[model samples]
Target: MLLNNRIKAFVELGKFLKQFKSTGYEKVNTVLYNDDFFDEMILKINTAEHHNGWFTKENVVFAIEQWADALSEKNLKEWLSSYQLDTIPCKTIGIVMAGNIPLVGFHDFLCVLISGCKVLVKQSSNDDQLLPFLTSYLVSIAPELNESITFTKENFKDFDAIIATGSNNTARYFEYYFGNVPNIIRKNRNSVAILTGTETREELEALGEDIFRYYGLGCRNVSKLMVPQQYNFDSFFEAIYPFNIIINGNKYANNYDYNKAVYLMSNYKLLENGFLMLKEDKSYSSPIATLFYETYTSKETLLTTLEKDEEKIQCIVGNNITPTNIDFGTTQKPKLTDYADGIDIIQFLSKIK
Candidate 1:
């Protein structure tokens, strides 16, 4: 009953927030540009988060509620019932955030919040400001959250359990050091796309949003492309080239220059656009200026390979219509309820709570 009530409340909140399209978005984006948020971000991005550009505040709200709705009836019930109900209490959940993508750690934040756990977020110093400001905004909506959620600068030590994300190297340490407790220690990963048949120009236009959103600095970004061998590259390039904005300015240019030198020196075939580069690498997630490639024979073979490598892939951002799991599988924008690690998040939080 309580869970149902909370869902209804969230829906109501969504309804109320829907009207905040223009002004609310403006405020959030404006605040992100302000130095206040960057104080936390500086630990990671130096001065770059501000320099790179902030996603419209509207993206944050849109993604969040998109997630809330994504975690809708059927999915929510599947996961929620996976564990027994009855408010589990006496919890303080700590989250080690990720900076690979904008507000990537928000899922863990939402999980802990929903599970009634005291959230002690050890934010990725890279994205310090976003989670803090986001938390503050949530508190504004649900004032009771002010008491529950506390964004901290203090290093978390004596927590019951933790949910952390880091590079494979850091994940090793987190798993060992945090081994004394139950936690979700995430290693590095990213999403990809499989362009089999036809993709429209508008779809490609929209697809560019996924590629350049954070200048390809996100885990959800399509760093790998799996196209059928017969598919000509020209159409794909044409569909995506208009949003060639990824190659401009400073930060992105640095990435282009650096990777271009390495490729030029090593004699690798690099398709360049000043900002984005396509190189032949097995790396699922490429550096800012580069992308990985593997030609596929058939969709069946591609599915088989992907299924085998499911553990490595994080999300799939393509133009496919069908819903997929073990895949962030969506051609359209990803709804919020979609999660990373494909783990039972609420259940994970519940145990700690």
Candidate 2:
């Protein structure tokens, strides 16, 4: 299929997704294949939590809304404008997807197909349902794309390159197995926020979205905070209070209770506001319902530390804190060009031999 054809199909998929959003689902009569897909998609979104407890209906809807906004013709063209998609030689690309959040691995799947390569996907069983259904919708829109997408339960074979996302442990195995091929193997990386004690309450509340979205499971979630020395937590707690309803969910409440109990039993000093816990730590990865924070004496020293540990960080959220800093509340709403771990998948695929 031509690149334009693929873009048109994805735009249709986006339109189909636009019907289902956080506000509500509204069926558009003009959307292609809705008679076959529209109602089933709603069922999947509503019952996603049955497969994975973290896949709440609200979060799943939020994810769909984000993708609906992202796959616009304008956005797709802008993201692909710099790439020579037609010139890239066709090869079968293997994708090992992580199921940390709903549709977390869809970007890699989109890139492989858009670059004119066949994709062999091994989806994490935790998130296996939604993507296949969406891919089916895409295929229904563009029958030619049916040949380009494959989902597998067994080992991948007959692939020229690989893209794998997992923890640090699985990364070692990915490097061992796919080491000879052109591959992008991503490991554990966390996002952090830098506070200068000048952020408005709105910005701080927005930061709560970054922290609490996906229940803090995504690599882009701000799991840690870097605040100025003696920076007070009063404002931060007050701004994030609106999100306290997150604790009402049984799974989240269980995690919060368990973590809090463990901390108290261990005699750890904590700053908590009923639902969320704030701890003083240096680690980038924090547990559920907890946000780790560290105080920095100087901006220069903090930048130096972040630079030194760049590979361990996925995003740095703040206002002009760094050249690449993402604004607050937008970490989960990544653009297509915002490639994970700062590695461009298009450039990598274009050069694959």
Candidate 3:
């Protein structure tokens, strides 16, 4: 399919996705697919928990709405314009997707297809349903994509290049297996917030969205906090109190209860607001229901430390910390160009032999 055709297909798919969100799922005739297919999609979204407990309807819908906003004509054109789109020899790119959050690997799948290449996807068993269902919608809108997209459960072979997302441990395995090919292997990275204690309640509340959204399962979620030594948690706790509803989910409550108990038993100091727990630690990857915090003695020293450990950070969210940092509440809603691990996927694909 032509590049413009591919963009149009996704734009249509975005419109189809916009109909499904936390508010509820509604089928509009704007999509090319019939009601039966749309109904099946609704069923899948509703029952996604059976496949993976984290794929709750609310989280899935939030993901869909975000993608719908990102796949607009303006966003697509602007993002693609930054790259050289001249067609390369259409190679098959194998993608091993991560399932931490809903549609976490969709961007890679979209990138390979838009670069005029076929994508062979090996989806994490945790997230097998949503992407394939969306892919089916894309095929219906543009049948040409039927040839371009493949989801495999078997061991990967025949693909020329690969993109894989996993933990640091699996990354070693990915390197061992796909090392010969031009590839992008991603590992775990967590976002952190640098707070100066001067942020307004609204800003801190927005930061809560970055923290609590998707139940902190995404790489973009803020898992750590950097604050002044004597920083007070009163405003932070009050601002984020609205997100307390997250504890209503049994799975999340279980995690909160377990982690809280573990911390108390270990004699660790904790700051809790009944729902979320804040603990003083230096780790970037905090457990679910808990956030690790560190007191930064000085901005200069913290910057030096972060500069040295850039590889471990996915996003640095703050106000006036640096122009490069993402604004609060916006980490989870990444644009198409916000490549994971800071790797330019299209550039890598374009250079693939």
Candidate closest to the true structure, highest TM-score: 2
- What is the Å distance of residue 115 in model 3 from its true position? 0.6
TM-score of 2: 0.99
Model 3 bad stretches (over 4 Å): none
Q: Write the per-residue lDDT of candidate 1 for residues 260-322, one digit (tens) a residue.
A: 898899999877655567776766978776777788887788788788877778776555522
Between candidates 1 and 3, name the one with more favorable lDDT. 3
> Model 2, stretches more than 4 Å misplaced?
none
- Clashes (backbone N, CA, C under 3 Å), per candidate, total 7, 0, 0
Tens digit per residue, CA lDDT, model 3, 34-110: 57477887888889988888888888888889999998989999999978787566999999999899899999999
What do the candidate models score in CA lDDT, each in turn? 0.63, 0.95, 0.91
Each candidate's TM vs. the true structure? 0.77, 0.99, 0.97
Q: What is the Å distance of residue 214 in model 1 from its true position?
A: 1.5
Q: How accurate is candidate 2 locally (lDDT)?
A: 0.95
Q: Which stretches of candidate 1 lie over 4 Å from their true place?
A: 1-85, 140-143, 318-332
Candidate 2 residues 193-286, lDDT tens each? Answer: 9999999999999999999999999999999999999999999999999999999988889999999999999999999998899999998999
Which residue pairs clash in candidate 2?
none
